[model samples]
Structures are given as structure tokens and as C-alpha cells.
Target: MRTRPVLKATEPWEKLVWWPKVMYEEGRYRLWYEAVPPDHWDPEIGPKLAWPNPVFAGLLCYAESEDGFTWTKPELGIGSWDGSNETNISLGRETVGPMGLHGASPFMDPDAPPEARYKMFWYGDATPDVVKAARRERPDAIDPRTTDESHVRAMYVGTSPDGLNWIVQDKPAVVFSSDTLQVVEWDALRKQYVWYGRGWSWGRRTITRAETTDFSRWPLPQDVLTASPINPEQTDLYTNGKTRYPGDPTTHLMFPTLYDRATDQTTIGMATSVDGVAWNWTPGNPVLPVGSPEGVDAGSMFVGIGLVPLPGDRIGLPYAGYSYPHKFPANLADSGFSWCTWTRGRLAGVHAQTEGEFRTPPVRLAGSGLRVNCRVQSGGSLRVGVTDEEWSEIPGLGVSDCQPITGDQLDATVRWSGGSKLPVDRAVSLHFSLRTASVFGFEILDER
Candidate 1:
């Protein structure tokens, strides 16, 4: 918790580097994000809410990276910003209304059609006359923020062959009130299209989830991951950075940016799920905290869409950092992207003050040995035992016979008297006992 990510990128014209989602495809990494202008204001007129600034309200730009660390933006000359086709824009403002497109989430579907291989889900602002008429008819009778009138702020889908060119669906697929980041990802493990976006509850931010076999139709959104029961009632969570846990399909890892409206500070916190619909919000710690009290990210720190495994046993997570309160000043380009890392499997762990034990659910062993991701302190150690169906420890595989394991290792193998001789066909359980250590995860090592 409270891990740090280094500043990764910035753009001269990108005043507010908004929601960024990254996808791995074409043998490289592609980052799709929204860019806003430096001068942010809430105009009295609804039409001018986005200020007609092409780069501010509706600029979607693309960037590429080789290692998920260093990034480069290619000038596509696709959009006419400030007069001519002279920006690194992906979706041109000429094709759509200003600030119409936001929160662009690119997804690579293996089971998708060839022509429409790459797809995106984003907010398309279309001020409908029905809602407008109702507001005019009875201004005092409605609260637009909570009313279905705001549903005109809809979510639309677009397909692209190369993540650049696109064909947007003519009509809004699912209409909902959206302002913050919305994510759409293909859950390969579950074979479903997962949609996580913003919904209002008690005038604060809340996350709602919906699943569909087809992107065109989604059922009513249900509240899933939000502020835990223990958190202060006013604390808000934005952009549940949900991703499939590496090496384990049964677990989903999420790092939601927890924002405290009182302090205006944002940090990434951990929440876990066995099924994407239900979540267990980690209490009292952040997977990554906001920047320093006087630092660039002091105000907000929203983790980006992708999580990459980097060299030297590190995990790369991109995040956008910005100062708090959103007041504009001379330095409007202070907000940008940052890449952070962690020791493998350190996102969540069971800590032992002096000694503790935990037994994992039964698992079939298809490999020769077992490996564990854990860290052992200098004055402490860890030992793991295998149990049978009856919860009985096998001879030479009991805690007393285990080799005392030490060190911070991502894949430290468990050794017994006879290596690679554990029973393979039966469902066995791993019982771990440790002293002053943190056990992250375990895996059955295949015989080479």
C-alpha cells in the first residue's frame, strides 16, 4: 500500500489528461485517453458546458509504448484543432459534437469479427429535446442530475480495424448519466462483456456494473463496488480499475481511486472479487496513495486502465495525477500520466506479526512441485504443508518436516524430502504457517 509510480508522459496542449485506458495489441501497447483544456469553467448555458474547445471537451488522443513505461504520441493529423489538422488526435472534432466523446475504452476481442476487431465504449453527449422540453415545462418539478433526462448522456460503441479508423453505432446503445471514466473490457475468463461506469447515489459517486453477451444491449445497472460500509459516508470512489488477476482467473483485482471530497485527495485502493459482480473492499490501506502534500499528484491520482508486468520483477500501472480543487492557473499542464510499480504479488498479502497460518482451498496439482510468492524478514521464516482430502498432512510433508523458507521471492519453491513426488491426481490443499512474513500467493509448478 502507498506504492509510488514515476511520471510517464505529458503533452503541451493537454491541459487536463483525463481518463486513460491502455490495451495490448499489434505486438505493442496502445493508450486511448481523453484530453481537456487548461481553462475549465461551468458556463451558465448548457450548450457551452464544454466550452466548444475541441481539445478540451472532446479530444481523444492515441499514444504508443514498447515497455509500458516510455511513451510516444504519433501525429495523425486527423483533427482540425485551433484551425488546422495539426494535433495527435485520434477522433476528430469535426465528426462529432464538442465534448461529445469521453472515457474511450479500447478492447481487443479475440472472438470478434475481423473487420471490427477493435472496439471502444465512450460517452457521446447529445442534448435531446425531450429532456429539454420537460425541463422547460416544469423546471421546479425535476432534478436533472437524478432524472432520466440526464440519461441523454449516453454510452456509445465504435469499432476500429487499427484502433484509429472507426465506425460508430448510429444510435446510443445504453443511455445513462456519465461524467467520470467508464470501462468496457472483454472478460475472457467468463466470456462476457463487462461494463463498469458511474451512477449517482446520495449526490456522490458510485460504481455500477452490468454484463452482456452483446454490447448493444445491457440490462439495468446494479450497484457493485462502492465506498465500503466502514468508510466515511462522503468518501467517493471513481473508476474501478478492474482487471483479471494474473495467473488466476478466479480472482479479479481492482484499484479504485478513493476520493475524499473534504480533503480533495485521491488514492488508489485495493478491492477483490471472486465474481466481478461482488467485491471485497480492502480496509485501511491503499495499493497506491496520492502524491505528496506538496507534489504534482497531491490533489488526485486515478490509475489508468492497464496493468503490465515489467522487467526486474515489477508491475507497471499507469495513473493520471493532478492538483486538487481544479482551479485554473498559469501552469495548466501540471496534470499528466505516471507509471508505478510493485514487487510481484504484493498488491495484497496476509501478514503475520509473529506467527499466523492460513489454508487454501483444495486444488489439483498438475505440476511437480509448489511455488509461493512471499517475503520473509531477516529474523523470521515461513513453512508450507500439504494436506490430504481428510485434512491430514502427509508424512514428510508436515510443518515439522518442511524446509524453512526465507527471502522476498515471487516464485520460491516449496521443498520436501522427496522433491516432485506429491500426489498429482487428487485435490490437495496448501496450509501455510509463517512468522513475521507476508504470503502473497501460491502456484503448483509444472514438471519440466
Candidate 2:
């Protein structure tokens, strides 16, 4: 992993920043993240903030870039904070206050009406009045270890035409028995809105999921992904950094922060799902490990809610970094946001020490041409063949006819003697052979 973060909390009042969600649209990159100022509480409530409470909670802020790498936080002036309207505040204070801003997970919908093209799923409005009433109804409503649980911690929806300016929906979207990180995304493959957040199960902080055809009517969330039995007794999945795999819409990827409360350290783990509901956790260890002891992000490190595109056909994960005692107490000075990336199409790929091969599940293609991302060592080679469900290689596209792939590339097209088109219209699988090479992944090009 690269050593430094792409973004930092450099402003004087900037207490800490976390949970960044990014989107690339119309040739520009839009970033919506949760930023908390040292003095976030209202003046009336300032003196009452005796505990290690967030004086002024988080305010969802905005930043833009022609390229996703270089970001600029333009002063929107739409929200006021700490007696100043000088921050890049998108929605908070005077705009959508009483709760201020929390987790504003934004997504652009070309299919939505113009006024609602961009939408955000957020948490907050956990005001005293709301909290008191909620606590009366349910005594263990909030986690007292962090903040007051009485805050109405329901999920709310907001829409924007240009992503900066906003219109919060009048009604709340989803209500939870407790407060946790909420993330929402448009599931084009399923043609529904999928929501992932904190869910309690087996007496631990497990992950749960729900789907909604309409934004308002959601079925009760069910436990989808959870900590593995092999994990330590205190293992918990913190937040879901879920995003649709760009090339394969049918698959979903998530960076789940594995919380070991017993040890008090957090690391990022990888989870995959064909549908957004059930997940398959990658085994062994963290895909994105936490930093060293006493290092930034050593205490806790959660990945970006949105996975942006990067060069070399890779995916960029912009993450927020935090030091030890990963709490809101004492205001850890170095807490900020940073970034890391995974090779495209291969966040999880099989490795071949010397010579090995793997066969893909059957697929019927829109286009027969195959493109792959693979790395072959100097004396290594890679080959592909079309195979029947019974593992029999078809003619022309057989391994012997493959043009030996001898270089490292993200989009190297796999070819055979007769150009590698499927012989029959029925389903077929791909059999790959590698000698000192790693085949990341392959895609059947869409017919243009």
C-alpha cells in the first residue's frame, strides 16, 4: 500500500474526517465526506457538552476534481458553522440542522428525474428531543459508549440535481433499533435500491442488508454478512464499504472493517456477493490491513464508501485514517483521510507459484471476444481455451491454439488461432493455463 493519504484534515477547525463517498460523472469527480469541526455544537448546547461528546457533530462536505486525484473543496456557503460560513459545507447548519450532517452516501441516477438525479442516504437528526422520546420507547436505543442513543437515528434520503445543493426528503427512509453506518446504492442489476448498515445478531456487531423497490417501503433487514466463526471471539464487522463491480454489474464488492474490540484494532476485509443481500467473505486476513502500532489508522481504518476508478484498470479506495483510541475523545490531532487501490477485476485473484490453471463458471456472452488482466513473469506464459460444462476443450479455441500471453497488462485480449469465438450459441466456460503468471480476471466484451 502507498504510505501517504490522498486527502488530509488541514483546516484549523477540522477535527476529523471519515466515510468518504465518491462519484465520477460528466467528466468530473464529486466527493461527499463526513467532516466534524472542533466546535460543532450549537452555542446553546456548547456548555452542556461536558462529556467527550462531539461539540458540533459532522457536517457533510463536498469536493470536486477534474481528475479524481487532485481534489478542491470549493466553498459552497450554503451552511453556517462556528459563526462562519467559510467551509465547503454541502448540507448542515441552517440547511438541514437540528441533527447537522452524518453519513451522506451519495449516488447519481441518470434514470431519476432531473431534480433528483443525485441522491444521498444519511443518518442524523438525533436531537435531544428526538432521543429522549426514542429512549422512552426503547431504553437501549443508542450506544452510550459513543454518544447519546436518544437521537432519532433513522435513515433519511436527500436529493440534489448537481450533487452540491440538496433537497432532503420529508419522510425518513429506514428506521433502526440502533445507530450504525448506513450506505445506499442503486442496484441496476436488480433494478432496486439496496441498503447496508449495522445490524446486531449473535450478540455482536454483524452486518445486515435490505432492498427496496421504492425508497420508502423497505422490508426488515436480514443478516447477510457476519463475522466468520474462525475469527476471534470479539471479531465484528464495523462498516460496509460496498460498491458494485464496474465491469461486472452482477457482482458486488465491499471493504468491511473487521473490528476486534478485544484487541482494539481495526483492519479492512473483503467480501463479495452476486446479489447485494448475501455475501461471501474472503478468508485468511485483511485485504487492506491496518497501519503499524502508533501509526495513523492504527487504531481504526475504514475504507471509502465509494470505490472510484483509477489508472491501470484499477479501483481507487479513498479511506479515512485514525490513530489509537479510535474514539471521539481528546480530539486525536492526526486523524484524516487517505487512499489505496486494488488491481482492476482482481481485488481477489488466484496465484500460481509455477504452473497452474483455473476454470471459470459457465457464461453465455453478448460478445465472444475475451479481454483479460494477467501478469506473466519473464519466462512465463498464459493460455485460454473454451471448455464444455464437462471440461472438454472445443476445437480451434483449444489451449494448444492459444497465442501465448507473455506480458503484463490490464486489458490484454485472449486469443486463439481462429480468434476464440464460441463455436455454439449455448453456455460455455473458460479454462485458463498459467506458467509463472497470474490471470486476474476476464470479461466478455459487450457487443457494441
Candidate 3:
């Protein structure tokens, strides 16, 4: 399928909708996002500290839709700092940081028996006390000398019987100096509840993952993937790293790479994998290329958060829509929420569509033995000729100018290299090539 940008967020009032999740039980979709109020920041602290500004903190809001198209905001007003919502207030509203219950990934727990309940993994900041306590236990691991201020960032775990009231876990599931992003329920094959978060590396941004069988007793981290260039000493290769994946019955992560064309920034390339660890990136340039009417990702738009895998193998992307720096400015970033959807064609089977061959530098049919080499992807016909010109028009070869060699499935490629006797005239360059009429999500062979 050809990929396209899905949703574009372009207004502060509209920040209420994003990071969509499908509710299988009700056959609907839900977006659990943070609402940034107008004039919420205090200019005294500094421009960078505008968000987490304390005046207008994150209010975990919900929006729902039956068809995943149109949506309606439900006015529940259930969130409170004292944990007074009728739904189980697992986590306290009095967040350790300025914002509590920011960007969270919600899902119906598959590990829980049929009657257990739904779950949500919320990612936001922790209180300074909570941050210090966590760091004190790892004094050797935590360098207090580092004044990155991010040391206060921490992630808390939350849950709900219904989607409304919540229970904030007394202890957090994952905590790191930098801000955390999202989490998902690992599939049965993984046997763990995994959370994807972002943090600082020395002084730059990077993504990391940590998991556990039960929310508690969580392990530190095993490298899932790194964004650093092969040679970090060289400044040309680095990415503003982030990782997001689906957490439900099945699991997949969206791995993106930045293509900084400087003035003309490139589209964020993407890759998918069943497990979070071993990623199988798409081949060629990118799964999705740049040059579109969608909003530009200047200095802001920390978009590219999640995706909705459609029924017919299509994907609906939801992204932040605005023109950089101003899009997410300190106190007025709310004027940047708009959305768009991408629908793609899905290809199923593979069949040899067509094939042809030609010879260069004229050759004689009289004493020159012909050597034909071929490369095939998705398996296609190999056409060989005895002369510098195409000879499929001549008789007795048994194979047509184009013949079937392979079909559409996953990815199958084969190369043919053989020789035939021919009369000689002059040395000629054999033209062996591959052609396909079908487009596949994956490819198998390359000339080199």
C-alpha cells in the first residue's frame, strides 16, 4: 500500500483528540491525550520549560467514535488531584511533576482472565520527592552532578475497570531522567508488559524500553534499539529519537528515522516488527517518502505517536499538524491540532506479470556461445536471446517472450545464469533485467 500522512493536529482546543486506540469490545475507537490550555505557561522560568508549566497541567481526557472517523468528547470531569473519581483512583491526582496522566496508551488486558478488566499505562512526570527517592536508591547509577533537570521525569502506572475512573499505582512502572512516551501490553509470545520511553544520552535524546511479567518487580532495560549513528564521533548522523507501538492482543512498534534535508526536511521513515527487539526495517529509500501537502515538522510537532491498523490492511495515522516552533510555543501551542487519514491499496497474490531481454553491441549467430545471467525478485521470467537483438520472436525456444516464474506471497526471488550455443559475429553486452507489474510491501532481490 502507498502510505500517506493520516491526521494533522492544528488547534489548542483540538489537542483533546490524538494517539487513537481501538476498543474491540464496543467496536469503537478512543483517544487518550493531554489538553494544553491557552496561556498555560509562565514566561519567568524560561521558554523551554513552558510545557510542564504547572498553571494548566495535563487533564487526561477521552474522545470516542464508532467508525473511527467522527468523534465526540464525553464530558465526564472525573479527574481530580485527591483521587476522588468513582472509578478506582489507582494513582493520585497530585502528580509529582507539573502534569499527571499525560500521554497514556490504554488496552484491554489479554493476560487477565476473561472477567478481569481493562488497563492503561500512563506516562508523565513524577513529583520531585518521588524522583529523588528513586535516584537515591541508584546513587551509583544516577549522577547527581548532572544538572539536566530531566532527573525529575518519571512514569507512573494506572488502571481502570471501566474507561472512566482510574487507579494510579502508588509506585511507578518505569522512571528515567527524560520524559517518557507510551506503553503497550506485550503479546503472549513476549510474556511481559513493555513500556517504550525516551530519555537523555549524555546530553542528546534517545529511546529505551523496559518490561516486567507483573507491573511490579520491573527490570531495568535491555537494549531494544538505539538511534545513534554507526559512528557517533561524526556529527552528521543522529536522530530525534522516539518509539511507539500497539499494546493489545497483537503487538508492533513504529520505528522512525529522521531525514534532515535541512531546509526541506524529509518524511520520517518507518519500520514494523512483531516483537519490540528485532526490528525489520523496510528496504529501498523509505516506506513513506517526503513531499506532501501535510503540515511541516519544523522545530516542533513531536508527532508520529501511534497508528490504527485498518481492516483491509490499511493504516490510519494521526499526527500533530502545525508549522514548527510556533506550533508548540510555550503558552499558545494549543492552536495546532488538526487531523488527516491515509488509505492504501492492499496486494495479495504474486504472479509473473511480464519479462523481456535485449543484447548490446551486435553479436553474430555463427560461433559465439551465449552466456545469459539473470536476477529475479518475487520470481519472474528469464528471457534469453542468441543474438544482439531480442530473439523470442524466433521459433523453437519453447518459452514465450514473457513467462511465469513466481507468484505473490511473502517475498520470493531467484536468479538465472546459464549459457546457450550461438554462431559468433561480434562481442555483445548481455542485458539481463527484472520487471514486475505488481507492488509488494516487501522485496527479495537486488542486482548488486
Candidate 4:
């Protein structure tokens, strides 16, 4: 993976910019990130005001890019900072109350009306009245940790037309402090909104999930992904960057920031799931490992929510990097946004060092042809054939008749001596044979 810094802390209100939520729409890349004013963590005042305290929470800022690499923080003139409205601040404490936006995850709601095309799920200070009502009516939904006479924090749902101006719901959606990136997506299959956030498991941070049919009402999040026995006691998963693979929405992917309390450091980890609730860690994790001791991302890193499709058939994953430990004083820490990319549809692969073969389960061949993303090294090759439901090889489509696939290609056509055409709309299984090669994934193509 290749990584490069895209945005730096240049503006006055962007001293600790992080928690990037990016999107690609209308042929442009739009980014919304959390920006903290430098003074929020002042040496003297910082000691008194606890981190994440409502007194000085971070602001939600905006930026855009024609190409995912170069970004511009256009002055939106929407929110004021130090009596100046010429800032790129998209949402600030003034709009979302004293407790500013925390882990604001935004997505385009395809099912919503034009005026409410964009929606966000975030945690912030809940009004006193809302807190009181929640305690009285739905005490089970409130997080006990946030109970304080001064104020209470809760998750909120907000909508926007253009993603810049937002209409936040007056009441809290889920009365809990999901302090990590609150990822929400419209689960088209279930016809509901699914949310993934931070939850406590075994006294450590874990990824939680919740579903709701209505955007305004959400149940208390339940722990879905947690640390296993393999993990050290002091290690936990934080910031659930849950997202669907752009190339295949049916596959759920997460780039959870693995937090090590023992070292006070964090690194990005990969997880995969067929259903959003159940998850498994991807092998050889910490995919985007930390840098050298003195490097920018040495202390911690968190992957953004979206996987951006870039030029050159690559997919970019945006992330924020800190130069100091996660618990380091914000005033003394340096952070910025960067993105790393992988060859499109090649984030992970199935490898075979020796001669190996496998057959997929029966699937309806809706497309006319099969294309595969794979790489075959020298002295290695791959062959794909088709089989009937009963494991019988189709005539003229056996392994021997298959054309050998060699070299590297993102979408190589699988062909046979007889014909490359497939039995469209027929239930069949794909048989793959490999020798010292790797198969990333396969796609059904409409073109024969």
C-alpha cells in the first residue's frame, strides 16, 4: 500500500484535525473532519477542562478534492470562528451545542428526499431536558458513564441537503456516548438503517451495532465485534470504520483502529463480514502498520469511513495520523489526514503455493462471462472451468480445455478452448485451479 499526506493542520481551528469522513459524489471527493482549536488543550486550561469535555469539543470542518490526492478547504462562510465566518467549518459547537461533533459519520441517503439526501450519526452533548426525559422514560438506553449533574452525552441523528448545512434532530436518537466513529449505513437488503459504534466488552472498547427502521429512533447499541482470547488483555478495538466494499456491497469491511493500552499506541486493523453484525479479523492484520518511532503516524492512526475509488484502478482509504500516543496531550500532539491505496479489488487474495484447486458453491450465472482479478507469477498459472450442480465437469469446459491465465490483471477474462461464453441464467459452480498464483476475486460480466 502507498500512503501520502493530503491535508495538514494549517487553519487556526484545525490544530488537531482528525476523524475524517469522506465521500465521492457528483465526480468530486468531499471530506468532513473533526477540527479542534489549539487553545482547547492549552497547557494551563487543558488540565482543568477534561478531554472530550463539553467546554471545548472539536468542530466539524469540510474540504473537497477534484482528485483524491490534492484537497482544498474552501471557505464555506457557514460557521464562525473567533468572530470570523470565513472558515471552512461545516458544523461547530454553536450549531450542535457546547459539546461539539464527535465521530461524525456522514453518508448519502439514497432513500431520502433531496432535501435530506445526506445524513449523519454522531455523539455530543444532549440537552438537559432530553437527558431528563431519557432517564425518566428510557433509562436502559442511557450510558451510565455519561451520568453527570452538569450534562449528559448522547448520539444524535441529523440530516442535510448538501452535506454542509445540517438539520439536527432536537432529541437524542440513542442515549449513549458512542465516542468512536459512529458509522451508519442504509441496509438496502433489510430496508433499515444499520449503525456501528463503540461499545464496552470485557471492560474494553469493542465495536457495537444497532439497527433502526426509523432514522429518529434507535435502540441501545449491542456489542457485536469484540476482543478475542488471542488478543492481549490491554488491547482493544476502537473506532469502527465500518463500510461496504465499493466493488462488492454484500461484503462488509472494517478498518478498526486497534488500541494498545499497554503501549498507549494504536494501529489500523482489518476485519471482514458477510452480515454486518458478525465479524472476523482478516489474516496478517495491522494491514497499514505504523511507521518508525519518530514518524508522523508512529503514535496512532484511524482509517476513514469510505473507500474512495481513485485513478489507475486503485482504491484509496483515507486516514488520520497522530505523531504522538493516543493519550498524549493534544496541545503537544501533531496530526493530519492521509490516504493509502490498494490495487482495485486486490485488498486480499487467495494464494496457492503448490498445485491447488477449489470449487465454489452453486450460483446462478446471471452474467454472460466470468472475469477474475488475479496475479500469476513466473512458472505459475491459473485455470477456471465450470461444473454442474452435481460436481460434474461441463463438456468442453474442463480444466484441461481451459485457457491458462498468466501474469497480473485486474479483470482477466476466463476462457476455454470451446468457448468463453457461459450458460446465462443457469445455476452452476465455478472451478478454479491454481499453481503458485493468487486469486483476489472474480466478477460476473455482462459481456461475453
Candidate 5:
């Protein structure tokens, strides 16, 4: 899906803006992004502060919008810049102390008290004691050159009554440097806090996972998704843009940015998992490819951390776009924020050109009716049937009894001439037949 640019770099402090974390709450959309000041990369002064160290590079800023399309950066007078507290900066060198803010992932804690309603996990410099302990425990994980005052980094936790102001903890949450956006979510089903971030495997960057019952203490991460032999030879997974489908907890989705070392470019790919840990790449990789050579996002792009549900039954995925290669000089790169959308529940589909049929594994019926998300071309049609565990067609629920679905609909009820009602207490399987049609997904509906 191609993106439509919505936010751009306008303020002097926002010479380069990216890494967006968007949330929808209280009928308003809030966005937190990484904004880099020009001085951070200026040759004369950049070297003085060890600028561009992956962990201590940018400022965390805020923006908002009534609708997801248009956004506004409000001046909160929170973080002072150029001797004035007139910018929308939320966390910077002054607020976050010496570590500074690099990549911030903020989420609403449903289980927390009002005072700690909002929580954030960010990457920043590690204190001397924390760095020393990490090196002593896990020597291979810590970078060799990292010292007490230098490139040593770790993940930190903070809380906020509101989304703007924050209270950071004194110690680091995880001692290893994930060097990318660290995503954390409260898994209500598992009743634990789940984290996804960067890890190394086969000498390349890969997505890692960790879980804990307590949010304050996190274990060392383990690589969960890595570059497989099927991927291109010189490619690696850079960032894990992990999110769960709205209104559904069974499906976990990720849009990881694939970095191509040969061309020094990056693109987005799609993956899905049932339990958030074991993931499989969806067919037709590079779901969101870069634009033409002269286009604004030709060089590289990184999808953000959330999948927002917009009006008109659409899903918007936020991203950052750049006009220069991933390794291009920061001083000359052009970057901004934008979003791409897909039809609600249509991120992946099973298609048939001439004719095709497939049967789902046995599932216990929990609802009364079946509703499908599909599109049938002019000369095509789709039908659904029910089968027992032994692959025998159930009476009154065979394909021949089903009314042919002939039009595109986001949620079309599957009907059968015999009856639309289904048995809810027995195990059954669904069989789908299509001709020149595509089926995105199906849901068991409870008519009661």
C-alpha cells in the first residue's frame, strides 16, 4: 500500500522527524515522534557530545489530530530548547537527563492506576552500574567499546498521568541495547507484559521477544524472528512494528522493516502469528515497497507501531519516509511522517484465479452464523460449506445449498438455502470454494 504524507518537518527542532507511536483515546488521536535538531548532526558540535549514538540521538515530541489524516503539533512548554520552552518537545536531554530520548513507545496501561495510566518504554544511555552488571552477566550481548560514559545503552521505563508529562524510573528496565523501537503491550489473555525489540542472529539484525508478569522487571530477550534462508542473501530485519488486530486478541500482526545491505535501502514486510511469539511471513513479501527513484520515500521507510482504525471501515498504518538511503549522511537526509491504509480486515487474502477450494481445520462452533470478508469479480463467485472432522459434508450445509456470493462486501453473511443457523455445541470445519474471487477472512457471528 502506498502512503499519503500527513506530517512534515516544520520547526527548527524538527529538522528530521520519524519513529511515530500513535494512540486513539478520548475521541482524539495522539502521536509521539522522534525529532532531531540540526545541531545533533552538525560536524563542528556533533562530535563534542558523541552525537548520533544510536541510543542518544533524538527528542520525543508530541502531536494530535481529530481525524487521523490531519495533525497538529501543540506547544506544551515541556522541554526547553534554544533558551525557550515554546516547542512541543515532551522529553529531551533536559527532561530525560544525560541519556536523552531515542525511540519512545508509549501505551495506555489498562491495569494501572490513574496516576500511572500512561506508560512508555524507551532506549537511552545506561548508568555505569547497570552497564557494569550487564557486561559481567552477558558479555556477548554488550558492545565491546561501551563504557560508563559512552555508547553503553539500555531500555528504560517511565510513567505519566497524562501523555505529555512523565516520571522516569531510576534504573534501566533491560540492560541490552535494542537499538530500535522497543514495543511493549499488556497481553490480557496471557496476563503478562510482552515485549518485542531488536536482536542479533546469524550476524544480522532480527526481531526478539520477552515476557514478564511484572512490567518493571524484564528478562533478557531471545530472538524469535530471524532472517531465514528463504530471504534475499544480503537482507536483515531492522525494526519490529508489532501490533494486535483491533477487537481481536487471537491475531498478532507485525510489519518489520527489511534492510537491504546491497542497496542500502529498506522496505516493509508483513507477518502474522497466533501467539505473538511464533511468526510466519505472509505471501507477497515487501507488501509496502519504496517509491520511484525521484519520489519522496524512494530511499527508505519505517512503519510505525500502531494499526489505527479510521472512519469508513479503514485501517491506517503510520510510517516514516526518507528521500535518501538508509546509510545516507544524516545532515543531507530528508524525512517526514505519513500513513498507508487497507480495507478493514483485508491485510491478507486467499485468491483463486480460475477455481480453488480449501478447508479449515476443525473448530468448535462458538457462534450461530458465519460472515466473510471477500470480493468476487464480475465473472466470479464464492460459497461456503460445513464439514465434519472426517471431511464429510454436513447435511443442509453443503456447497450446493449455499447461495453464491457475487459482490464485494466487508462483512457479508454466508447464507444457505436450507438454513442460515449453525450448531454451536459441536466441532466442525469450514470449506471455502472460489472462482475468480478473493476471501480476506471470516468470522463466526453470534446472532443472539
Candidate 6:
């Protein structure tokens, strides 16, 4: 048996930072992480500042390293569209909107019409009410840990002709609200502009995919990755936010979220996708585990969206380090810091030998109640065909959502089928077909 590799947290960086983004640029690695003062960032209420808690805003810090391993914090100065902080907003720059600015995802356009080569999209609110709400909510009025949604923010975009000069767009790019961990990439293989972000639902998060011919406008939303709540093996696969790995489908690697329930620790994990949307987990999906159990980063760490590739082709990731005491007083917020990590070599991928096998049950008699359970092992849409004694596809039964649950154990139940309220009990085979899971064939279960 192969031994479980031990990739412990090494030196040169602190832990428990929130929203770590990595990127590769100019034959070197650059990282951007979010950090606030430890005492100011109330753990009970998270990065969001509660009432009278003395909340300090978030900042985008810069760090550069020769090797991806060791990093040196450099001065990029405060937020700037240009090298100078003239056009940028300062700390505590509050807008009357949802929430204040958080970490931003950076994208470089080498072929950007010779005008602008860099763009950044971030989560924030320009609404006045949100800004007021941010100031109103306090530990003095209510419990700091309460979940309040009075102030919701939208995702906004900014552009830079060079890394130094940036200009915030007059209008927002996406209208949805939630703290965003975004990755903007131009895929040469698919020739599409891919934006990866997570949609919050069901006390968890799911990966959402949207494509655009141009970066200016986006179409309707679709679920590229759904949340797998009941699956224990997939417990760590929480947020589907950013992907820092370089390369297209074949060598593409992504940095995702992994929250351990055993200790309520949040950190980044690793996974890979082929077509830039659908993802498959490599062995031990939680690649970068929690920080040291007894160190500065011992609490939890979220992700940021920039990954700089270093000279030797190593990858540098900038992340925020957070420290929230498990057992703490009610009003005190969690503490946080900024740090980074670098990775080398090609990440792992999921192995599929024979694809997958899907089968729909036999036909049933008319007016008989029916429920279908088509479980898919791999992550893909499962289609079941219900024949009307003569064999035909039932309209609604053909709906997709029965995506495989990692190992394919998803069950779907439907009412009457065969164009009537009836039970299927005929000698018809249950033929299962899969779309977008993998390059494989389905199996046939002969009618009973």
C-alpha cells in the first residue's frame, strides 16, 4: 500500500489568513492576501465588523518571493489604479451599499487590444444602506455572531493598463450578493472567457459557471458544480471559488475550500477540471490541509484569487490567515492575518478506467405509482428513459440534476410515468445515459 504523504505547513509564512489568491506573472510569483488587525477582526462575527466592535477594513497586500517557498512582504502601497494611491479608495472607505471591499481576483490580458492588460473583479457594495448597516450592526446591540443579511453587496470590476494603474468600472459586472472568491481566465482550448465563483445555498456553497463572448456582458447562470452535502468523503469540498493552476483542461489545477467539521477549521483544498467547468477530485482531495495545530495560523484560512507562477515555474498563493478561538466570549470577534504558500510540480487528477454504467428500471403498468432512483457514481448528469410499453422518453423524467455523487450514489424519485399515472411493471430495460461525466458508455439492465 502506498503511504499517505505528509505535506506539513513549513516556515516563512504565517497561517489563518482569509481569501488567499495566487497567480503567475513575469516569470515570477506574486501573491495577494487580505488581512485586518487581530484585535479588530471579531471572530464571533467573522471578517464582517459588528456594532461597536472597532472594525477595521480589509487591505490588499503584496508579497514577492524568489522561490515559491520563501516569500518577502513588499510594498505595493495602498490600493491604486496607478502606482500612486490617488485614484484608489483608502481604508475605511465606506460606500452606501451591501458590504465593504474584500479580496479581489486579478486577471492579466496579454492580448487585451493593447489598451489594458490587467483587470480585477471583487465583492463589495456601492449601496448606501449597506454602508449604514455595516456601521449600525454592533456587539453592543446584539450577539456578534448573528447572521444578518440587511447589507448585501454585488461583485464589481476594475481594470488596469498596467499592474500599477487600475480604474473601477462605473457599473458592476455581476449582480448577485455574497463575499466572492473569483478567478478570471481566458481559456485557449475552449476559446471562452471563464469566470469561477460560488453561489451560497443550503448552509453550504456550490460552484457556478458563466461564459461570455466578451467580458462586458454575461448570460444566465447555470450550476456547473452542485453541493454534495450528505457525502462524507466530500465534506471538505465546500466553496467553489478560485482556480490558480496554470494550463488548460489537461494540466489545469484549482484551489478550492475544505472545511473540516471535526474541528470547524476552514482552509484551502485542491482539485482539477478538464473542460474548465466540471471538476473531478484527485486522491485525497483536501490537498493543502489545515495549518499547524499550535501556531499563528492554527485557526482557519480562506482563499484569495491570484496565483503568480515563479521563475522555476513554481506557483505562489497569497492567502489570509484567521484565528478564531473555538471557545470564546460572545462579543469578541475572530482574529486574522495575511500569509502565503507556494506549490511545485503537477497536481493530481481523478482516474477513470471504464467510465460509468447507468441503468433505468423496467417499464410499469398504467395508473401505477412510480419512483425512479438513478444514481450516478462519477460527477455527471444521469438521464433515465421510461418507455410506454412501446418504449419512449418521459418528458420530465429526462431532467438533469442526478449528477454523480463522487462515487455515483444519487437517487431520483418521480411520480407517475408513461404519459399516465401508472406504475411501470413491464419487461422493458432501464437504459441509462450520461452526459458530460466522462468519455464512457452506459450499461443496460434487462427488464425483470
Instruction: State the C-alpha lDDT per candidate.
Output: 0.71, 0.72, 0.43, 0.83, 0.83, 0.47
- Greater TM-score among 2 and 5 belongs to 5
Superposition error at 118 for model 4 (Å): 1.0
Model 1: how far is 39 from its true place, Å? 7.2
Clashing pairs in 5: none
**Listing every candidate in turn, what is its Cα RMSD in Å to the true structure after a full C-alpha superposition?**
4.4, 4.0, 11.6, 2.1, 2.3, 14.5
Give the lDDT of residue 326 in candidate 6: 31
Cα misplacement distance, residue 295 of candidate 4 (Å): 2.7
Minimal lDDT window, size 10, model 6: 1-10
lDDT of 6 at 438: 27
Candidate 4: Cα lDDT at 377: 90
Better of 1 and 6 by TM-score: 1
Tens digits of per-residue lDDT for model 5, 90-209: 887786763367768988889989998888888777657777776676565454435554456788888988978988886777677787777888888888889899877778899999
Taking the tens digit of each residue's C-alpha lDDT, what string does model 4 give over 151-207? 667888899999999898978887887886778999989899999998887788888
Model 4 ranges with Cα > 4 A deviation: 43-56, 144-151
Candidate 1 residue runs with Cα over 4 Å from true position: 1-12, 38-56, 129-151, 247-249, 326-333
Off by over 4 Å in 3: 1-26, 42-57, 80-98, 113-116, 135-151, 178-180, 228-251, 257-266, 284-306, 309-313, 325-434, 439-448
Candidate 3 lDDT over 1-448, as tens digits, reads 3223233333343332233334434566666555543323435532443344443344555666665556656556454432334321223244323344555656667566543356666555555566566666644333244354443544556566776666566665545443333555554676777766554454544455677788643545543544434313321211212333223433364534343434323333444566666654444323333323443433333333445555443445554433434213434322232232333322122223474433445443333333222224554444433223543323322233323334432333322233223334344333333355333222212222
Per-residue CA lDDT of candidate 6, range 1-448, in tens?
Answer: 1011111122122112345455555556555554433334445644455323222234444555555556665434444322354322222232212133554666776667645677766666445554344336422322232244454455566666754445666455655543446667776667777777665545555666677756754443455655333335434444454554544335555666666566667666665666676776555545555566555345655555654444443444544444453323312433343334433333442223445444445544343333333333444454444444455645444423222223232123332233433224454444445544321222223322
lDDT of 2 by residue, 229-347 (tens): 77888888877888877646677888888888877777888888776776788765587777876667767787677776775566777777788644435265467666667777667
